[model samples]
Target: MILAQILHSLFFIFVSYVLYLKYNNGVVKPSYIYSIVFCGLLLFVFNYFFKGLSNRLFLFLLMFSLSFVILQFMKKFVNVFGNNEELAKRKQLKVNVLSVQDFVFKKLFIGLICFYQLLLIWVPGIFEKMMENQ
Candidate 1:
């Protein structure tokens, strides 16, 4: 059970890493093929344990899409604030961006990342419990 949970966490880590790479480079690296395969294994495990396919698959699709969207937003925020030397000079972890709007967006993006991270942490366990319940 512990091993399964670890694998589940790895699934999220690998999937997010792959997405991060793909978003940055727009090309899939040969080395990450195995990671991709591991992710597929989890998906298959989900499919195998859960009897119904058509309806549940939509939920999975939405999960992946939401992840992609959050990643894109992260990239955009980084790009928007990434250029300034002033932001780089800051001592604290928090930065004071150019305007209130930028600050709000930055906080929002950070919140989204935190929320998504929690989702990644809990989702596999949720799937496992659901599978066991069936």
Candidate 2:
């Protein structure tokens, strides 16, 4: 079980870093450090709760695949929205094209993802306690 937890934590960190890098296209900004902090906290919480789950290997594989797919979908969606807006603005200005150079959007997106992961690890515990009280 300890070994399984360790493996799962390592894999989770790896996948998260991969997703962040893919979204930023290998660009490492200062904001990406949140990924490390969130991953660390997530691993600690996951290992504490790890013993309850059976078939850790299978679940880890499933989670990794799902996260990758979700990240790809979100990236595509952001690209479409950003591209469309840029195109509209450029057309109005009668310009050929303009590339997205804003780092704010990517940073905000990554920060939200990190926040969501923290909530995922926390909110269930909160709800479980509430259920016990009732």
How well does each candidate superpose onto the true structure, as a TM-score? 0.40, 0.38
| lDDT: worst 10-residue window of model 2 | 93-102
lDDT per model, in order?
0.54, 0.50
- Cα error, candidate 2, residue 133 (Å): 15
Local error of candidate 1 at residue 7 (angstroms)? 0.5
lDDT tens digits by residue: candidate 2, 1-134: 55644454454545556556766678665555575557545655665676522343334334544564576577666765445765676674434332233343444445454444434333445535644697
Q: Candidate 1's residue-wise lDDT over 1-134, tens digit each?
A: 34543544455566555555555455778768786676656655764675323225324533754665676677676775567566677734225444554544444444454446446445655645755798
Quick one: best lDDT, which candidate? Answer: 1
The weakest ten consecutive residues by lDDT in model 1 span 50-59
Residue pair clashes in candidate 1: none
List candidate 1 segments past 4 Å from native: 46-62, 65-134
